[model samples]
Target: MEWRWNAVFLVSFGVVWAAMTTAKPVSSLDPADAETRMLAALEDQYAHDPGNAVLARSLAETYLDLGRPGLAIAALRAGDPANLENPMVAHRLAQAYEASGRVLDAYATADLALARCARALGTADAPSGTPVPRFACDARQHMALSTHQEALGHMLEWGIADPARDARTEVAYDLALRRASIASAR
Candidate 1:
């Protein structure tokens, strides 16, 4: 039993030592160089697994962080269309579209995301009766509303005069107001 215990300890110590020695220290690299390295690694992984939605999203986010919204759009498009149903993917794609001077596309994409959120939460249309304050506090609904608001802001900033955009903006504003009212009531 003593020998067996000693052997186990030695093996665990060796593994830990090997890991500590082999791991690269992140603090040693310059911020820009580290970002470039991370981007290259993610790109390589993406190239090997082109259909990976998570990888595609990561690459898109990295490109966005680097101020390359066009590249971000390309990265997002490289993945499966089904991935767009993911709120994060839709939000990022909308941002990329807006940054690339496609305000209408951004608005449409955001609207689609909001619709998805509503469908997922089974709140496509509010109840016809008295409103429940708790309904306004849903996190998913807040995310959808915020994304829609952002898209509307971009459209308004671009001076695009469209009734659809105006209506969506008003809806987002109302949702936010309701959320505030609910919070204050609590």
Candidate 2:
């Protein structure tokens, strides 16, 4: 038992040390180069350990920087529910949908993901243990909302924000209004 405890302590200390010094950082808008490479390494680890749902989710997130929605979707697909997919996979799916020019599908998926986050918010893990807050825990809600909102913005800005003043004016206006509404509510 003594030897086992020492081994565990040593391993835990090593992990903590690495995490403190070498672990990658995350941000909502921009990530540093070191962070990017760390994400890539994490993705590779997920690929090696296919059964780790948390790893799968992380791998999907990391690939977002690579502008590879398809691969991100692939990784998130492998993630399990519970703590993994309920939210992120949905958002990434929306990204993939949008990239594929499936605007309606993209909106639908993003909505569902945000809804899931909303549903999970402050509920299961509330301080007072009250019912779920009907939205995400605080950070989670904002993150979900941000991703969906950003996706909508991207959809609007995808084609230079240039509109066809001729026949497609109505279509352009509709899209612009939708994006504007989403952004304003942000």
Q: Which ten residues in a row have the lowest lDDT in candidate 1?
A: 128-137
Tell me the number of clashing residue pairs for each predicted model.
Answer: 0, 5
Error of 2 at 41 (Å): 3.3
Give me candidate 1's TM-score against the actual structure: 0.57
- With a 3 Å backbone cut-off (N, CA, C), the pairs that clash in candidate 2 are 118-135, 121-135, 121-136, 121-137, 123-132
Model 2 error, position 100 (Å)? 3.7
User: Candidate 2 local accuracy as lDDT?
Assistant: 0.58
lDDT of each: 0.67, 0.58
Off by over 4 Å in 1: 1-32, 126-145, 149-186
lDDT of 1: 0.67
In model 2, how many backbone clashes occur? 5
How large is the C-alpha RMSD of every model relative to the true structure? Answer: 18.1, 18.2
Cα displacement (angstroms), candidate 1, residue 25, comes to 28
Best by lDDT: 1
Question: Model 2: how far is 16 from its true place, Å?
Answer: 55
